[model samples]
Target: MLDLHRLRLLRELSHRGTLAAVAEALSYSPSAISQQLAQLEHETGVPLLEKAGRRVRLTEQAEILVRHTETVLGQLERAEADLAASLREVTGLLRVAAFQTAALTLVPNAVTALARSHPGLRLRIRQIDPEQAIPTLTARDYDVVLGEEYPGQPQPRVPGVSLHRLGRDPLRLAVPDSFDAADLADLASAPWAMEPSGTSPRRWAQTVCRTAGFEPDIRFESTDMVFHASLVATGHAASLLPDLVWAATPIPGRLLTLPGSPARTLFMAVREGAHDHPAITAFHTALRTSLTTLKTTLPLPTTEADPAS
Candidate 1:
């Protein structure tokens, strides 16, 4: 019989992409990880990893095992859930993965609300990018993931994972506090701090700039929304920001709607088979309610209002 624990570690190495990262995340020493993986390969009687220039790469056999490991881990999670359900109590750790902005401004309030309602539940939150969050959630590292999808961009589809739309955050053009640009076209020559390429927000910002008849001169690149706002405030660079970033503290800038008034939809994702798990269901409810309340409190730009008006 294959050892499920070792299989899980192997699966995590594949998802996390580094032995050091896996060790740090799982709280194991790097040498310990190496020993366990070496033992796993010895027991299976196949070479699972190959040394690249600096990092170890998984062999084809290891990739195959990783795929099956996902199934095995998922089944194990389901079995545990079933046992917990049989006991008729929701008492287990719920791990959540979320991006920076949502983690900073939204999730804390939601967690507080959840704790008030369900005192028995234990929660663990991790700050992770949306791109990584989906895959990790599918691998069962996270019970639920808070993810975002920008307007006109294709949302990533993770097989066997289910998504629930929580709320929409309007995207706006953020300019320097004293600068006056009649429209997006007028700011074509302005320096921009954009989300890194391959992210949904970055793609949307580029498309919006193109549609307005100019390509942006992107001077800085980062996925951190707080840093993006700070650049705009300090006159270093302008950017596109969502309403959620302004929820707890207002960014000192002129917020204007894009030509189409685009909005990014935030959602909660879970493994399709584990949707009925009590902890997942409860947290989802709390998140939705918190977002609903936030919509009323956050400062959102009026689509029809002109910045000059």
Candidate 2:
């Protein structure tokens, strides 16, 4: 029988795209990863990798094995979940990755609730860039991921992960104290601060601007919305920010509800079969409770005059 552990290594290589990355994710050395893949090749009696100048690519045979490995891992997750659910308490470590805003607003409350509700369960979290978060979750580096999707751009479906929409956070135009705009187009020539180029938020902001009939003079680029808020607060630039920014820390600035006033969909993703794990379930319950609290407590704008009022 093939080694299930080695099969996982092969699958991880596919997901992570390099031996060093797989080793870092699983806490092994690159040499060890190479040796294990070599052993797998010996067992199967077929070459499973082709060296491509400092990196390795999986062979067709290795890809086939990874497909089977995915099935096996998923089944194991279901089995583990079934066994865990038969017990009286949920107990395990859950690693989570999230971007800045959710980490600020939702994670703290969820962590507190989980501590009170499931004393035996533990959580480890990391702040990850939006581009890398879900991909890392797919490689089994995280048990769950906090993610957001802007309206009109559905994330492409990733295999073997289950996603649940948490709630929607409204997006609004943030301007320096002196800036004024009756409509999005009025600020066409204004300086803008946005997430770095190639990110979903940057692309979305660009689209929002282009639709308004001019390209923004992008004055600053950063992934941190807090920084975006600061730039707006100080009159350095304008930006499109989400409600979660203020949900974390209230800052003095003008927030305007744009035309259509799109809202971003917040969601969580876990491995497909692993979604039934009791610890994950408990965490999800806590997060939903936090969302409810935000609904009642977060100061969502009622109308254009409300922020001024």
Best by lDDT: 2
Question: Tens-digit lDDT track for model 1 on 1-309?
Answer: 888888878888887778998887787898988999999999999999899877899999999999998787678668776776776667789998998888987899888997888888899999998787787675558888888888889676776688987877777888987666867888899999999998888898999899888999999999888888888888887898888888755676888887666778888888876777778878888887887778767666556432211
Please estimate how well model 2 matches the true structure, expressed as its whole-model Cα lDDT: 0.85
Which residue pairs collide in model 1, if any? none
User: Which candidate achieves the best TM-score against the true structure?
Assistant: 2
Candidate 1 ranges with C-alpha deviation above 4 Å? 1-73, 86-89, 138-140, 304-309
lDDT of each: 0.82, 0.85
> What is the C-alpha lDDT profile of model 2 across 1-309, one tens digit per residue?
999999999999998889998999888999999999999999999999999888888899999999999999999999999988888988989999988998988899999999998998999989887557777676678989989998677886888888987877778988787887666787898889999987888888899999888999998999989988989988888999987788776754777898875878888899989888998888887887787687568666665332211
Q: Estimate TM-scores for all models.
A: 0.75, 0.89
Off by over 4 Å in 2: 17-21, 50-60, 303-309
Residue 270 lDDT (model 2): 90
Q: lDDT at 286 for candidate 2?
A: 85
lDDT of 1 at 247: 71
**Decoy 1 TM-score against native:** 0.75
Model 1 global lDDT (CA atoms, 0 to 1): 0.82
